[model samples]
Target chain A: MAASNEFRTCSVTGLKVHLPAEALIKANAVVAVVFLAVGGLFGLLVALTRWQAVHILPAEWFYLLLTAHGADVLLFWVIFFEVALLYFASAILLNCRLATPWLAWVAFALMLAGAAIANVAVLQGESSVMFTSYVPMKAAPHFYVGLIVFAVGTLTAVGIFFGTLVIAREERTYQGSIPLVTFGALTAAIIAVFTLASGAIILIPTFLWSVGLITTIDPVMYKVIWWGMGHSSQQINVAAHVAVWYAIAAVVLGAKPISEKVSRTAFLMYILFLQLASAHHLLAEPGISSEWKVFNTSYALYLAVLGSMIHGMSVPGAIEAAQRKLGFNAGIFGWLRKAPWGNPAFSGMFISLVLFGFLGGISGVVLGTEQINLMMHNTLYVPGHFHATVVAGTTLAFMAFTYLAVPLVFRREIVLPTLAKWQPYLFGLGVAGISLFMMGAGTLGVARRHWDITFSDAPLTFEYPPAAILMMGLNGMSAVLAAIGGLAYVLVVVGSILFGKRLDAPDAERPRFIPRLPTTVAAYGSAGTLHVPGTIVLVTVFFMSFVLYYFVNWKYLSEIWPMR
Target chain B: MAITSPEKRVWWNEPLHRPEVIWITIAFLWGLLMFGMMVYWHVAGRQNLSNEAYKVFPEKFAEKVEDMVAKYKVREEGATKIPVVRPPPGSDVYVLSRLWEWWPILELEKGATYRLHLSSMDWQHGFSLQPVNINIQVHPGYDLVLSITPDKAGEYTIVCNEFCGIGHHQMIGKIHVVDKK
Candidate 1:
């Protein structure tokens, strides 16, 4: 009963793209980019301020801009892209119309308005209470209201995602439990409900207090509730980006997961257990018991770790299995050697998975431990750890997906193809350097939020070892390098989308990519029973790195407590 | 309902392949090992694993800190003449936290237990002692008491790890662990 114009076949993937869903996706993506540009600018400023040599911003402006940078990047840009991805996964991938298209637009408008209001409030210089915004120290009422409005908008959008899935089911889009990518998006959407609800639970009361409706807002109560929103927002990113990883593998390599059930179970584990990571923030906080910390931080937390490890092994395993099937079975790493290194989509996803595992994953486990958190919590090491996860893992993966999404969705031939090819390495290398140097400085006891480590103007004085200063200087240099790489990405991606040549040719001349890159998902050459010694060796390296790093941190901890 | 992709069907409901089984098993064992280590460390006192922290009234903490400071004032200029409280070995001690500074520098005897109490007067702050590297979040309404027996005698710097205010970066405290001879 659907109208003819409502859907059209995509020449590249051969899947029908629903017009409503595609429009919504494009809208969200365009907005996401604007936020990214603003956020990136703020990020550069914050980085320069953090650089001891630069020390660009004065104290008040330093904190105000820091708040803006965090909100724009972490909340605005990431969530907008995710909502777009949700619609893509549900409607277009399922070859069904988007449910409640009008409602979806309303939600987008609310989110945009909310973001504008929040940004303006921050710039107006009333709400410099950082992203954590631990209370007793209150912001203007409008700031909390803006956040609540944004959260409600996001909640409505997530509802539309579920509605789209229901339409996909009724329209008979596909059979047998949807695609693995859709399943993973579903996981993200499920977690988004928990994340948004946590925001409402805490922020509404905070808003009321700000407006003089309430007498007192307890600090401990606020933090315990607030982190459910804060930390789990990243959890949503993890699930979404992991889905993007699987989708990239499928699109670029024509790779099927090694075992769909195992991969599905891993996503399920994320839904059930990943939210517990919020406790890591509260682990050292007063009014929380050690028993609660031990329960959340240790044995129970391992199930979630196991979930990620399963994914780390399986994603590469899927790639290796597909590669070996292509007759690249010469040596342990022949498959990896033979991968499409020229494609940014493939290269970025691969780097994201590797660093996300080695640096982010291992350091996360170490930082989450109750005993070890004593040394690393609230240090520069914490940000170093998350930069690996959010920046290296999630943002890089999103950029990889965007490269493919542009050519496929925007119907434009990618301009500056050569720059696109090398952008991942440039950005990934710079980000990796930032992570290492910051963590090194943190390990030597640099403060997490301090504008000046030297404490030049403070009443009391203390000096960090010369090495820690050197590490921070290296971190500053890395930030500049990473900023350049970020510019390359913005230029190449935005340039390609806006200024690239339009492709409107008929079927015969419609090459997959105009510049003659291998754009198709390399076919499943032959189905063989998974033989992946390459991935096995890589996983082993990951394991060895993890164990060595964990022990090294413990050794460092012991040395700090000489009184013991 | 026809599933569009046959390859998806080929692997979706199929049994776990050999490699996945092996990986999952090793992963399970490794997680178990980490879990066991944490438990063993807790039992053996080989970790920074604290278990004795509890809540106390802010007024009580305020009174104790005031008494200790009055008893041990290192008087020079009255403005900066904040006392460095030296409680005897294995006694109860208090450290009060407020805006811009952690109050009343504490001196403890080496190799003896002192139950150190912490609370904030205004907002949430962090108790981050350097060189020793222990961090605890201090809040206005609750007390966090940590039992410590200093095995090394040295001056340790205490930095507030939480972003309490503009002076958050300036919030500093001190712990002087003297020889017990």
Candidate 2:
């Protein structure tokens, strides 16, 4: 792949690309899709199992599948995609060569090996201690070892991303600060460093304990430290997906951030306080002080929320401003109405932005509250919030980007154009149902990790409310819908890569399968008159939902414990 | 200068617009309010128990469980309910968690406060009380004291929400709150 440090600029987009870096980008992206498919399959089964009516897997298999599903989807699939994005942002956008091709390959190999080892451990039955793997309930030593190895690889990739940035700066790739999208990637990379380090700090000793090298490990201490990896890992996703949102807006709509400095400051806020969101996991756990929980849960007053709200507003606001510039400004939502609804990239991202903000972002703050967390933690509500963020938010956004990559990276036309257009809505709707129904069941007191909520086989049986059962059934139907949606995505992407017509370069008579957008947004005009009242209205809706949901949780908490 | 190019005009270096400034102010105010609420809840609401935890030995915990079990064996109906340890009003009560059961059903009086000490004998457990819908994580070798006053008197089931073992779902405890007789 590395004949030389040759360069080729994309004629359509006009960005100079280092040829060696392109190979890495393609490799990482392809691998990410593969993991997403596998992880998604596991997710479907776990959902079916949780359905209770289906009860697909028995207790042991259920736990085993849950572990694999969490690890693969949450960690492996997302990180793989993120690493590809990191390369795209730094090397491609900045028009610089990836710092070390050999090291990047090594990182990829480590990640592949680590993912394989961890999966093997879980399948072997000894490591069925779901993804959290709380200490004292030891998994096989290889489980921790595998995770450590994977983290090290991801950490190496992040380091390489930083190195690429340094090279871009040194070579004067562009004039001023890097693009806002690239800046967002930098935020993700920085957080990755912290997340991986925390994994190593906690997991290494746990690995030792598993192997009998250490006598004992405290479960509470393990939890407190583990979320530094677990929850912070999700934070990494938040940053990366938010970056993807910005990139999609630019690429699909020629939208610029309403104010680059404001957006960058938001990214800066992410670096400062986003990881503190991990404290939400420990809100109800013993061994942590109330002062610690309160301070961290509030995160110095939800500054992290401020960061997200900024991104939320800027992403759509810029799109609105740009659309108005193009004369789509017929009414408050004319720009929105006239948007490229057929382009899976725009539609998927827009849906992701809305669902993520209203469903995930709002519920997150509700769960982050010290008192209210008591009602939500360890319930299906926790997963409900995350599915919105990770699946509805990140995974959907990544799928949208995949549409862009199939053309640019793989040099193939997207297959089933009509199906491609509708894929996001179908899949997004399924995921949304899953999130909402699970949260409803959780609110009705459904256990997060229970094999069976019914407890049918136990000597003493307990039946949940009829509402809870009904909710799980609804969640099950949603899971099936989401699975079908996921299947459509995989078919379209893979079918496109394999059977679709190939594209010809620059000025030929034109190949059969040319991309809809010859080039992404490269030279769109500046952010025009900031008369985005439409965006203001949408954000207002978001704020109202957040306040209402938060207040409802407090009211529920009040009812639970009452007063002294 | 009629700037036609996007790259030529860097949005960051440019002056902030009215919309951006306005949204920033709103967001900052909201964030400040959330943090303020958190502090107020912690200080004033006396909500979210966290200052009441410390490490405890497993052996001493087991001995205490045995004592509580032998102290209050109450037989009712044909089926045998686990011993119900009736602690005095406003006093601390200890409940031991092991294998797949939370033992010594603690009966407390309504309208009076009681500190409930929870710890697991094996692995880790979750103190999930149904109906009330409150969850607190319980770890072995750690005493998590939940300071509570049950306003609604009845029999509440304490289910272990944390995934402990094969029978984690079956691990249930009963907390009966009666009137001050």
Candidate 3:
């Protein structure tokens, strides 16, 4: 048991932070960043090789590094960061001690060891089976074993999060439905459980097959079960990042949700229907019935997508309502214009929200459509779509939240304030380019994971449109820019923790971590009829764009060769 | 605030604003429209993916491809030694995807329809037809059958988009659609 004195009152938020949970958050976050750096470098190499004009790596290295890049970034960096967020939402926000501090440390150690083992297997150069690791193409046994260990570790961390929630409730830490942020984290944790179980069911047999205990894993079955884990993991990201969006709004602007019932109901939709989206990956695969595909891919009438659309409106609506209450009510966009653009936390979160809805959300729905998937399955467009969602959306949101966490949780001031101000825009712009250009190239029918898009040296020949090559070149340039932005973020974050001014001592003269807002605000319904005409206008624009893009894809499908 | 517990104990009973009600209704209507389009396309659209698939052993699938090649081989494609098989209109055409190559080049009439049978001999592969932009997943032990009609006359390339192995990029096939006499 931790000592009662282990709690520290945050000078900024006035919340009691459990010291053990804080340390665990710090450790997990640091490891997550390290993997991000490693994975980002591998991704740069992949982009350069695909550029064709500057094809740097040989064929073998290209496939191997692509595999490494997917695993490290998609699995290691993202999951580790999510674990840290679980602690921050539960133990830290609820103002209670973490359940089983020793067990939390064990989880951390297991994750580190597992990541190291998996990376070693990949680097050893035989197990270049991409992230999907589709069957009949065998990889080293350690690859599966490493991933299983990693999943176990993540599962344990999720268990701790649930246990801590119980602790908070039993200790009567606070009142009234455990805060909206904690509820959102609870949504992520539930999805994580389903995802890990799916991973175990498929991977264990694959592992046994690798070691000669089992034989002949069916390719169709592997794909069906594997996507249950793969796609659900991204859903976990959606829930977590949406929570971050709400958290940033609250911390930066002291914004309360317009209606708790509405927002929470949207999250409930995700829990019920989001996992059915695993069918999105299997839409074009053989041996799957159209009835099954239509039912699962549409999520029993696109209810999960409806959930996202709700968040898309409410997140900004909350911000607009808060800004208006602060007397920024000149026009429709006055709330937006008067927003704190200079603050990295606010800027990053806002950028994440917009890019996610426009690029990721739109492209994902198009690709998931059963008939339209024929034009996109296994194309570079698939990666382009996901990069927008995971990188521009979830990752940027996480990075934004870090700026606030450094000061509040880590007890350190930001080291390079000027660089922090510009990092999100630079990163956001570069990633947007990557996603757009890759999708452009893919629209011209360029294959993904191909070492040579030109089909140079093949017995047969095929020529892509000149525009496709141009898109790859532009994508390579964007990757270089994103790499610089990524480097700026790492330096600022790592340098701050090590050398930035500490805020440990109870000095009244200390600088504020977040901008000061009025302490006493009007209660939810009492705040004189919340008017958010600005948010409504923005959502309308979004709706129009979505309608246009959706029809354009159907037009593209019509131009393809007649098939059934 | 989202970071703190709601001041009201029974927050679920709170009334939604006018804008939210309007937006949710619009979004749900849009969702229903998108769903309807997918179902509508199957009935009326020319371009649609086939859900007709059958499970078979790799050996049996290979034998079928060989038999088709033996029956329909016209000539060896220049320098490559792969047979360009011209199956008759409305007939079953088999193309095999192996380790690093898609075997047996195919030639079809521009206005003729044929049943195309695709399956892999080893790992899973993606059958990506360029220019026309039709793509489908091909897996071993599963024969994916598609009824394809070539509406335009030209040469098209089948690029293996899935990552089969180190030689995945090298796996390319061809289809030559001749004009109807």
Q: Quick one: best TM-score, which candidate?
A: 3
Candidate 1 residue pairs that clash: A563-B151
Which residue pairs clash in candidate 3? none
TM-score between candidate 1 chain A and the true chain A: 0.96
DockQ (CA atoms), all models: 0.46, 0.47, 0.76
Between prediction 1 and prediction 2, the one with superior DockQ is 2
C-alpha lDDT of candidate 2 relative to the true structure? 0.82
Scored against the true structure, residue A125 in model 1 reaches a CA lDDT of 88
Alpha carbon lDDT at A357, candidate 3: 97
- Model 2 stretches astray by more than 4 angstroms: A1-5, A507-529, A562-564, B1-13, B76-81
TM-score of each: 0.95, 0.95, 0.99
Tens-place lDDT per residue, model 3, A1-564, is 458899988887788999999999999999999999999999999999999899999999999999999999999999999999999999999998999989999999988888988999999997999999999999899999899999999999999999999999999998878888888999999999999999999999999999999978998899888998999999999999999999999999988888888888888888899899889989888888888998899988899999999999999999998888787888899999999999999999999999999999999999899999999988999999999999999999999999998888888888898999999998999899899998898888999999998988888878899999999999999998888888889998999999988877787334333788776445544333668888989899999999999999999899888999
TM-score of chain B of 3: 0.97
Best by lDDT: 3
Task: Report the C-alpha displacement of residue A425, candidate 3, in angstroms.
Answer: 0.6
Residue A431 lDDT, candidate 3, scale 0-100:
91
Predicted candidate 1 versus true structure: per-residue lDDT over A193-289, tens digit per residue: 9999999999999999988999888887888789889988998999999999988887777677777778889999888888887788977776676
Per-residue alpha-carbon lDDT of candidate 2 for residues A1-564, written as tens digits (9 for 90 to 100) = 223447876654667778778888888887888888898898898889988889998888888888999999899999999999999889888878888989999999999889989999999988989889997888998998899999989999999999998988787876666887788888999999889988999999999888888999888778878999898888889888888888877777677776767888999998999778668888888778777887788767778888999988888888887787767879799999999888898889998998899989988888888888888779999899999999999999999888877776666778898888899999999999999998898898888988888877654556779999999989989988988888899999889989976753555332222233333434333344468889999999888888887777777776776422
